[model samples]
Target chain A: EKASQLQTQRDSLSQKLQETELRNTELECQLLDLEQRLENRRLESESFRKSLRSLLELLDGKIFQLTELRDSLAKLMESDSS
Target chain B: EKASQLQTQRDSLSQKLQETELRNTELECQLLDLEQRLENRRLESESFRKSLRSLLELLDGKIFQLTELRDSLAKLMESDSS
Candidate 1:
């Protein structure tokens, strides 16, 4: 009587453990997927930063050239005015 | 007799299930953290893009102004020479 009851409990608990382990594996897979996605996003962000930096450098170069032109123009105007 | 064996088996499997549940909870928490971190990085990336856009607009404006200045200077020189 009591023996049969214990046997049944043991079987039920073993089943529960199996279910739990299966669920654990599923969660692990999901975490791995999230990690991979995050890695890709990080790479994308890094490339964006690199591209922006180069663009800013190019704009800075253009600004420098324009400033030089402006200065020369100012000098010419000054000579003209004088 | 057999009751003792079954009871022991049930206890051990119950313990395993408990431990597995705890680990599962921990994994869920970690996944939540990764999601939050990814969200933050995405927002940061968006802001960076916005900043770059505005900077490019400002640089375009500067270039336009410089070109205008250059054109006027060129006209002045032509008149001066003529």
Candidate 2:
């Protein structure tokens, strides 16, 4: 009788352990997915920063050209007026 | 004899259950931490996107101004040539 009871107890424990192990595996998978999402976000942010830099440089060039053109035009007008 | 054996089995299962519970709690905490990290990354990405939009608007305005300046200069040159 005692042996049978012990056998039953062991069986139950074995089942519980299997369930816990399965749950652990699921949690680990979830953690991996979350980390991957974070990595993607980081990359996206990096690309945006690069885009910002390129845009700023392009705008600066345009501004420079405009300034140069305006100055030359002013000089021409002054000479013509004189 | 069977009763004593059953008691022993119960004791062992109880111990195993306690240990499993502890491990489960730890996994749960880890999962929470990972989720928090994901949230922070999402926020950072959102801020970056917002910044990009603002920068694009500013750059557009600058480009428009430069184009206007260039057009005015062309008009002045044409008038002088005529």
Candidate 3:
């Protein structure tokens, strides 16, 4: 009777081991998927940063151009008034 | 003698064909590279547009806040004067 109980305990332990291994494999796969997603996000962020830099530069150029245009307009207005 | 001349002509034609093929391949590669660069530029432009939109919204909000603050200060000054 004790031998049967011991056998049953061993069977349960083996079943638990298999379940644990399966869970570990599932977790590992999930981890890899998450890592891949993170890598993609990093690349996307890098590209976004580069685009932002370019846009800022473009905006600065436009602002400078607008300021020059405004100054020219002001001068023209002053001359007209004079 | 005529056969020898024909053979020489054929060889020249074959060499020209190979050169043309190589040129075509090079042009194809350049075209692909340009297309990829254009795609990257387009994506960059899209992100830049989004960022600019957000920035404009933020600037508008701040401007509205500043206007409100100025109006409140003006009212306070008027009351003090009275």
Return the top candidate by TM-score.
1
Q: Top model by DockQ, which number?
A: 1
> Considering only chain B, what TM-score does candidate 2 achieve?
0.85
**DockQ list for all candidates:** 0.80, 0.43, 0.01
- The residue ranges of model 2 lying beyond 4 angstroms of the native Cα positions read A1-8, A54-81, B1-13
lDDT of 1 at A50: 89
Error of 3 at A58 (Å): 0.3
Error of 1 at A63 (Å): 1.5
What CAPRI-style quality would you assign to candidate 2?
A: acceptable
What DockQ class does candidate 1 belong to? medium
Instruction: Itemize residue pairs with steric clashes in candidate 1.
Output: none
* Candidate that beats the other on lDDT, 1 or 2, i.e. the better one: 1
Residue pairs of candidate 2 with colliding backbone atoms: none
CA shift of A67, model 1, Å: 1.6
What is the alpha-carbon lDDT for the whole of candidate 3? 0.66
Superposed by TM-score, candidate 2 places the C-alpha of residue A15 at a distance from the truth, in angstroms, of 1.8
Give the poorly placed runs of model 3, Cα more than 4 Å off.
Answer: A79-82, B1-82
**Model 1 spans with C-alpha error above 4 angstroms:** A79-82, B67-81
